[model samples]
Every structure is written in structure tokens, then in C-alpha cells.
Target chain A: MRKGFRTVSGLTAALAVTAGVGVTTAFAATTTTSVDFQTHGFPTVAAQAAIPAGQGATIKAGDATVTIPTGTFSDPVEFELLEGPLSSFAANAPSGQTPVFDFAFKVVDQKTGAIVMKFQKPVMFSLTNTDVNANSMYYNIAPTGTYTLNPVKATISGDTLQHAIAGAPVGWVVTSPATSVAQTTSPITGLPFADWLFVGAALMIGGGVLIAVRRKVS
Target chain B: MRFAGRSRKQLLRSLLLVGGGALMIAGALEIGRIPLAYLRVARAEQTTVSKPLVKVQIVAPPPAKVVSYSVNALYPPAAAPGHQPVTGSLMGRLEIPKLGISAPVTQGTALSILAVSVGHLSSSVLPGEVGTTVLAAHDVTYFHHIDELAPGDTLTVRTSQGVFTYKVVSHQVISVGTNVPNTPYPSLVLETCYPLDALQLVNQRYVVRAVLVASHLTPSSAANQ
Candidate 1:
């Protein structure tokens, strides 16, 4: 009787240890890094966030927020401000001419400050005179990398000729990851529920073995 | 007597055996049902076709008289010049006589836009502008015959500002992760997924490089027509 009890106890202890190890491993797999855009302007946020390759990062600028979804980064990256022209509007330019903002920005490593990406292009912003009070401003940002800026709300306010632009933050210009199709494995051939089956089988088998041993003892 | 005189241990053993047998049978049944559950989920996901997030209508070309000028005369004064109104419409027409392709170039490369016409990647330089102007289209449809293009092929873009002509310089196949090449002079880059004959999606991109060779003044009245 004592021998049978000891055997059952040993099996229970083994199963408990296996479950504890599984839980610990799962917890270790996920790592998250958060970035506050309000505290650090885009240049600083881009410089600080340690987004992993194939993963994503989230940015919050005051009331406006955007998510840099997974697969946005082909590799790990940090952003740094390179010497370039700031976005500005011309007051006395030709009436038909759209204002151009040519600038250079770089993506670099957060710790090493090594440059990973650079862009020097003339990005244009158009102003449509909607009545005398409010003008609708429009611009298009096409990403060159594997990153995308989710819909963001920004404000355009400045003097009649030159305005201080806010909410028009530009960073992480890249293509959004394509939606992935979930593939179905042949259930009969590849049982995803095999773990559950194993657990149930283990429970039943352990119970049966205990019973059989008990019978012999009695 | 065997039933009435059964020991407590014997009764406990019988209960354990019965309970274990029942659990094993339930597990087997559950294993059989898993595939069915997975099929239902897969079918649901497959049937759900979401619309493209951004949809911009193709804008009509402006009325302008085509006055062909030499490429040398059309170079912008600056590598990155100030923004000039190129077109009033969101779409421009790209004409490649060599490939017999004349497709509307929309503002964005959304799947919906690519379905019927090519897409002008946003932030890319406009036609006649100095900088790299990147355009993308579906390989199967609009750019199906892109591989037939050769160096020196003439390409024209009719935008709001005017018409611009380009001569193909070279072509190459690049991995998707690689950055698109840029030039200090006026250039055009056409991109599409490669292996034009591939039955499935491929990670390689076929890029065609072209330089501005001519500029044509579009008559204001012609754009209206």
C-alpha cells in the first residue's frame, strides 16, 4: 500500500513540475517596450524606442495616438534627426505653387546611434483656401520602408503666410505589413489539440495505474 | 456475498477505473472534433474580403497642348525644388508606347487603385520634377508586359502642370527589403512584383529606371477639352 501511494505521488509531482516549466517559458517569450511621444518629440521618440525586428511600437502625442503595427520594422531601428530643412510654407510664392518641404531624416540605432536609414525628398503640402477664415491643408506621405503611420490627427495653425504645424508629425515612413491569411492545418494529419489529448490521456492513465496498483496491494 | 462484502479499497479501485475510461473516451472524441472546428474558422476568414482602406477616384487629365522640349531644357534648377502644381487631379496618365500601356496613375497604391490603374506612390516626385518619381502597378494587369521594355524606350506622363517624357536607362530585380535607388536628376522608377509568370506572390520586385528626356507645355484650353 505504501509503495503504491509513493508511485502515485511521484507521478503527480512530475506533472506539476512540467506545468510550472511550461508557464515560465511562455512568460519569458514576450517583451514589450512603450514610448510616450508627448514627452519626447518625434525626433527623440524615434531615437529612443527599441522596437524589435518584425515587431511594432506605439506612439502617443498628446490626444493623438498612432500604432506602428507588427512587421512595420524589417529590422530593429532607432530614429535620429539628421541635418535637414524643416517644413515651412512660403507667404509670397506664386499663387498656384504648392509649398514644398524638403528634409533629411535618418533611422539609427538607439544605443549605438548608427544610421540605419535616411530620406531626403521634397514632400509637398497643399493649401486650399476654404473661405477667408479656414484653409484646408492636405499632404500625402508614402512610406518607403516596411513601416506605416496609422491614421493620425494633426493641426495646422500659423500666420497667414507661415504657420506652426502640429499633429503633422512625420516619422517611420514605411509600408504597412500586408494582412496575413490564417492557414488551416489538416486536423487529422496535424492535430493542434494534441496537447489537450495528451493531458487527458495522462490523467486517465495515471488514475488507471493507481487503481491497478491498489488492487494488487489489497 | 462478493458485492455486499466488497472492501473500501476495492470499491475505490473500480470507481477510478470507470472514471479513467470515461475521460479517455471523451478525449478521443474531442480530438476528432478539432479538425471540424478549425475548418469553420478557416472558411470564415477566407470568405471575408475587406475593402481597401484608402480609395481615391482617378482624376481627369487637364487640357494642355503638348509642346515637346528637349530633356536638357527640362531639368529643374534644384535637386529638390519647391512644390509646383503638377496636376489638379488626383490621377495622372502614364503612356509607354513601347509596351502599349496607357494607364491612369492614382495618388496612392491601394489595392483598389491598382485593380484598374497604376498608383503614384505618395511623397514621390511628380512628373517633370527633379527627384525619383516611384510608380507601382499590378504585374498581372497594367504592367503585365513590363518585362518587354528595353533601354531607350520612350515614356510620357500627362499631369496638371504639363506632359513629361522619359527614356528608360536600365532595369533590375531587387529584393523587397532593399531600398529604392534615388538620383540627383529627374528620374522615374517603375516597380512591380517580379517573376511576371509566378502563380504565387514573390518577394522580388522588378524595377525600371528612367530619366526625364523631354517636357511638353500643356495648353490650358487643351486640359479642359
Candidate 2:
């Protein structure tokens, strides 16, 4: 019974140490990964989601200098935003101002402009920032990532301009005429799977060492 | 004393068995909730607070591989009595060749059943013809991105007869009320309570209004014509 208890204690101690290491390593990884800049004045919510299966996400026009908010990427990608409703209003889509394509941007990046990480694909998306119901049930299209689409200019897909004249607010309708439309990867990319694994391993080894030495002394 | 010999061995085995079972259960629960919890968390940020009428297909299970739901169709399903004929003169189903958003549009304001459902049917007050095609989705769920739209953003509404594309011109935030429900304007009116969790009607609403630009009658209509 004494031997059994000792073994349990040893294992628990080892696990505790590992947990500690895992935590530290996780923090280290989080810290080392840098953020060049994030100016999400228009509500920081992810809109337009699709599984970036084979073809990957079509880079929206305004999001030229993309960064992987959390995960890692396999390579650097380049593409234009879709031309339709979502395509034309890339950076400023999440706003309430309407009818006119009067847009302004606060462009910021790292001082060095070294955007190493990128968000290659989004498995799902929602354009609504407030309606939880809409986010869950509204017009959601599944991902068609295996597609290779050519970069089309924003003007071609001009659907928003059409909505303004006939459908806008009572006084809000645009009486004037108009038209328009418009992540990451590193070699050791932030592939979420690999990142978590690296964290787990370091924790186990380091924790094992601490528990082993402590047992000898006690 | 003779029975005592086997009794000790049995007790030891039982203890080990019980201990192992407890630990295993704890581990499984931990794994199970990780994903479920993620969806709940994502709900805070990504959730659409619209009417909960749309169908949800649970593709992923617990441990939250479930990130987002896919929109199969937008309009409400047809009823038994020969799905109500869409109100007003028919326009073609709205189709945006770019974003791939295609849905049938009817005359008047939108119905809750019409908000985020399979499709938008004609409304009673405004009718689906040309005036207000008010689309009322639950504020937080489907209409969450309505806040993201600035003026000039475009949306296409396809009627049975023709296709019309509209641009956003203005927006308004109003408290949701049964008395003065906001429906489709001369454009697309996407409105919802501001925070979505506005149980007390405390939060102000946020609205996005857009205008219609081009109305194209597709050749597909001629084939049936």
C-alpha cells in the first residue's frame, strides 16, 4: 500500500509539473507572436465564413495586408476581394453609413511591415455584427474553397448600389446615381495543430524533470 | 477465518477498478465540453440575434469543431395549402453574381417567418413589389453583420419576374417594438436590437438601409415566358 501511494503521488506531482510547463509554454508562444496593428473601429466581428478547403478564402479587397489573428499559415497568399456586396465593402463593410461609397481607412502595420503570419482560410462566416439569430440562421453559404477565382475589380459586382435607390430608408434612399463593387503562412506556420503540440510536449518534458528531482529529496 | 483469504484480494481489485473509472469519466467530460463551450463563446462575438426560426444543422459535435452554421436556403418553406402566392407583381429572385447571394423577393415588408428563413416572401403593409422589402432577421444571429455595412454597400434582390440590385444609403437604430415594426423601405432594411441580449429592451437598435440600382430581367425568365 505504501508503494502504491508513493507511485500515485509521483504521478500526480509529475502531472502538476507538466501542467505548469504547458501553461508557461503557451504564454511564451502567445507573447512571441506579434501584432503589427489592429484598428477594428467598425466592430471586431468576423463576417463571411467558409471552409478554406483546397482553394482557400478569396482575399477581400480592403484586406490587402492581412494577418493571421490567431492561427498559423503554410504560405503567403495574394488575391482580390469579390466584386459583389461583400467584395466592394471589404475594410468598411461593418458600418451603418449607406448609399454612397464614401469610405475612409486608418491603415497601420508593423513599423518594419514584416507580416509573417496570415489567416489563410475561414471555415465559416457571418456578416451581421449584432443579430445573433442572423449569424446562426441567416444566409449562410458553405465553403467552396477548392475554387480558383480570378481577382475581379470591385466595380463589377455592384449590388449595394442597386439596393440603395429602391430599398433604403424613407429619406435615406440615394436620389443620386452611383455604382461600385469590390492570411498567413509561415514555414513553421501557426498551424494551430502543430502549435498546440509543441506546447504540450515542452510542458511534459519540463514537468517530468521537476517531479523526478523533487521525489529524490523528499 | 478460512473465507478471509480471498476477501482481501477482492477488496483491493475493487478499489483499483473504482478509482480508474472515476478518473476516466472526468477526462471524457473535459474533452466533451471544450468544443461545446467554444460555440457558446463564439456566440458572444459571432452570434446573430435574429428570430430563431432558421433551421440549424449540427455538423460537428462537442469539443467544438463546430465553428459556424451554413445557410442552405434563405426563404421560408412553402405551406400545405399550395405555398401562398408571393404578394405583388413578381420580380425575379434576387441574385448577386459576385457574393453568390440569391433569394426570391416579394412585395411589402418582411415577415419574421420571412426574416432569416429559406426565403423572403411578400409583406402585408409595404408589399414585396418595389417599396420597402423590410427583411427582419433576429438581430444578433443573421443580422449581426448589418452593422458592418456602410452606405454604398450593395445587395441584390431577385424577383420571380426580374432581378434588382440595391445599394445602402443610410441606417437607423431603433428599439424593437411590435407597434411600429420596421420593414423594408424603398430599399433593404436590416434592423436588430443593438446588443442582441437586450432582454429589457434597454439597448438601442442598429439599422442598415440600402437603395436599389439596376433591375435586370434575366433571359432565364424568357425561357419560361
Candidate 3:
């Protein structure tokens, strides 16, 4: 009886140790950040200033709001402010074959701290005009290199005008606030915690069986 | 006493069970590790701009440098009523009948644009123009069967201005430093990374060259004629 009790206790202790290790390792490997934008359209310069690396930011303007999760930017970035009708600017005016509003901005590099690259490429934004009187505006920029934007977490509140990036689709609606888009990632890539836990459980069961068989034979 | 007195068969079974468990764990780890590596490589490739296989200076051909050829004579440069300068917009649709490929042609080679449709190099001339209209796309997706194209294959491009058809002149697989031949007449160049089956970063490109054969303005534009 004593021997059996000792073996059971030993196996329990071993199982506990493995379970604790697996849980700790899993948590250490995963990191996440969520940002909520309470406003619609572009974020104000003052609001942009408060955004930190790997932190979420919510842009709320009127009834429209956009939520951007942390890790979207590899480094700190400043948003170029634009007000009034977007088409008023000759440069921002729609031209060429596609008559979509095109905007340009520079991503200020946090390191060496210079504006290393200019995002002159037009990022297509879909506008949902719920209010006919509301002025329409869009701020589009693709920040490459150190100021890389995570397209996965980047989303908007409007009808999707076009699908851009791998996961994030560009949405369009004149409405103030809507669930424009969302991004999903593979949980396995973060950490195979479930697999590790399974392995630990298997080991405990296998060890228990071996001990029981050995004791019975003796 | 647990193993010393045991039969050989029992001992062997115990050893096999332990070995099998270890192998299972190792296999699981390997399976989980490989996908992570592939994801890393794919992400890196998309983010970094890979050097072009051909080293031709990207120059926007002057508007006045028109090429006079028998083919151009057939499709006179009438005023394409709605023709506008290419500005990274959807210029047209590219179709290779033999390959049964039809994809939208956009104005820029930005990754965001290329992710959805073929990108027309902004520096290159537009279709029906007097220079090369360069187009690029991903190998594994839209242009996977590009290798199947041969001399004499037909490529048709439809734009807001007009519809242009071309005949394949030749194909080349060149390294990043090689220069694509410059022809005096309007041509079409389709480019993608070489080794269609490769999953790693490719250093060479498969380029298909085709010369203009026919062209016609869109019906609305033709009405102005």
C-alpha cells in the first residue's frame, strides 16, 4: 500500500511540474495589443501623438470610429493632418483613369529620426456616405521599412471598396461608424501551447501505466 | 527486478512504447516548426523589395516618340476620347486566350495593387502607346502558367481608350542584372519570378515579349471617328 501511495504521489508531482512549465512557456511566447478608435476618418495630430508602439489606438470622430491594434507599426509614426473637403486639394483631386481620391504622406522614421520614405502611393479608401451633407475625406499611406504598418490588424468602418494586403480589405461607406473590416491570425504560430500540454498529459499517463505494471509484476 | 526478470518480449514492448512516444513528440515539434519557418520567409519576401532581374532604367517614354509601323498604320492613333494618363489606376484587362488568363491591369507595381491583380509599371508606356507596356504579377497565383506561353501566342489588352492585340515574339529567363532588349516598335512585356515551382526567394525572372499586331478604340471612342 505504501509503495503504491508513493508512486501515485511521485507521478502527480511530475505531472504538475510539466503542466506548470508548459503553461509558462506558452504565455511567454505570445504577445498582443488592441487599439480602439472612437472617431471616424483620420486621427487628429494630438491624438496621434499619444499612440505608443505595440499599443492600440481608437480614432473616434462624430459617429465614425476605427480600432487599430498594437504592433501595427514597427516604429513610432505621425499622421499627416488634413481638413475640409478632400477634393479641394489639386494634388488630392481624383484624376487619371480611376477617379478615386489619392492622398500622400511621409512616415517619420523613429530611428535616425528622419523622414526616410515618402508614401506617395494612393491607398484606396471606400467611403460610406450615410449623411449626404457630411464632407468626405480619406488619408491613405503605406509605411514601409521601419514604419511598416501591420495590414492584418488595420481595418476600417465602411463598406469594403477593395481588398488590399493579405487580410485587411479596404472598405467604403459614407456612414460615420461601422464594422468595416477585421483581421485574424493563426493561433498556432504564436505558440503551440495546446500541443505541449497534450504531450505533458501523455507523458504522465504513460509514466503512470509503467509504474502500475511494474508494481503489479513485483 | 522490474526488467531483469521480465521476458524478452515484455522488455521489447516496453522499449518500443517509450521509443514511439519520443518519436511522436519529435514529429509534432517538426510539423509545428516548419510552417512557422515558411510564414517567416513569405512575410519577409513580401515586405522587402526584391531587385529586378533585368536592369533597364525605368524611364517614362516621352509622349511624342511615336513608332511608325505597318501594324500601327492599321490602328491609327485616333484621339481615344476618354484616354487619360496612367495614374496607378485600372488601365485595362489582360487576356491570354491560349492560357485562358484574364486579369485586371492596374497602374502601379505596389504590393497592395499586385496582391489583387496584375500591376502595370507606371514608368512603362500604356497600351496602344508607342513603347513597351510592362506588366508584372505573382508566379504562384495569376501568372503561374506563364511558362506555358510560347512564340506566336496571342495577348489581348482592353483599356478605356481601346483594345490592343499582340503576338508573342520571344521569351527569356534572365538574372536581375541582365537587360531586356529594346525594340523600336510598341511591345508588351510580361514579367514574373522564374522557377514557377520554387517556394524560396527567386533571383531570376521569366519575361515574355510580344509585339503589337492589332488595335481598335472602344466603341464610344470609335463613334467620335
DockQ of 3: 0.01
Candidate 3 segments exceeding 4 Å error: A1-218, B1-88, B219-225
Give fnat for candidates 1, 2 and onward, in order: 0.08, 0.00, 0.00
Ranking by lDDT: 3, 1, 2
* Each model's DockQ score: 0.04, 0.01, 0.01
RMSD of every prediction: 28.5, 29.4, 28.9
**Alpha-carbon error at A69 in model 1, in Å?**
61
For candidate 3, write residues B105-193 as lDDT tens digits. Answer: 76677655665567776655666654466777766556778878888889988776577888886778866545443332456788776
lDDT of 2 by residue, B44-154 (tens): 323322212122112122111001111101111110111224443222243334344343333322332323221232332221222344544334334545666667777
Error of 3 at A122 (Å): 59
Sorted by TM-score, highest first, which candidate order results? 3, 1, 2
| Candidate numbers sorted by DockQ from highest down | 1, 2, 3
A19-100, model 2: which lDDT tens digit per residue?
Answer: 2211100111111122211111111222223322233442222211122222223333221112122212222322232222
Stretch of 10 with least lDDT, candidate 2 chain B:
B63-72
Task: Estimate, for each residue in A112-137, the C-alpha lDDT of model 3 and write its tens digit.
Answer: 34331212122222222222222232
lDDT, residue A136, candidate 3: 30
